[model samples]
Target: MAVITKYVVERSGVEKMTFTSKAEADAYDKMLDTADALQVLLSASNQLTDEAQAEALALYLAQQKEPLLVALGVKKAAKAGKQDSEEQTTAKQDDTSSKGLKAVAAGHAA
Candidate 1:
């Protein structure tokens, strides 16, 4: 009964796909900005230096941001599922109370 939402990221002529909770989406965007900075540093260097390797590692982490967001979505879904069950229980209790009140008004219950 729960609906999943999809988000898309377009960068460097490639379209990236992701699904995430709102918080995760925001975090991923911030991480992506950091990744972009690393990319710029990597491009400016002509040699495969230590700095370039470090930048590459940062870029890899950035690419993983989307997967991390998806993991967040899984956790969110579990929490949301529990919340939905609680809401349903409350609704059923309300219905039962209403039915009892109607029966009492009609002299069907003491």
Candidate 2:
């Protein structure tokens, strides 16, 4: 009998790619994870179109700044036909408010 190890990759909880080597899979996964983090900020901004946000995020990564640290909640996949754009927009605002509060608290402590 032979045993095989496969490197499965995912982004935003959806499988994206697969690799034969752990190093390759991990590298790609890390990049995707970073992009996901950036997307949260981009999504909340509502200023840039999706395309522009992606480009801006890539530029930021190219500069090699320390990655933004955000504590994310485990969100269930929205039920079909239950969530619409309006709800999504409101949720984004709520998320931004929480993040802002965290920043203010940190500032007060410092």
Candidate 3:
């Protein structure tokens, strides 16, 4: 059997994690240390209120913003384009049927 180790991120005395290897444990420890440092900096900076800490923590977890925004923008544009195409197709069908009815009416009048 292999020994499984754990790494924890402690904030306000709460710790949580699991690591399969020493390297993974070390990496997690480093991440936790960095997070602690960032929290200290944030507190010192006076940039976040108590209510804003969660958002700050989330930003730390993700590490960067540009890539996230790009991904979200791509998904939003794709969704909008699909909706536009569906609406256009429905409008075209409606117009075709309306024109066909007009043609049939004209033939009957003649």
Better of 1 and 2 by TM-score: 2
lDDT of 1 by residue, 1-110 (tens): 99878666656767654646666766666777888776776667655557757677677867776565557673345467789999999999999999999988889545
- Candidate 3 colliding pairs: none
TM-score of 1: 0.37
Give the best candidate by TM-score: 3
TM-score of 3: 0.40
Candidate 2: tens digits of C-alpha lDDT, residues 1-110: 98888899965688878888999998787776666676666767777677676757754663343322211223433452246766888999999999999999999999
Among these predictions, the greatest lDDT belongs to: 1
Which ranges in model 3 have alpha carbons more than 4 Å from their true place?
A: 1-14, 51-110
Error of 2 at 35 (Å): 0.4
Give each model a TM-score.
0.37, 0.39, 0.40
In model 1, which range of ten residues has the least summed lDDT? 69-78
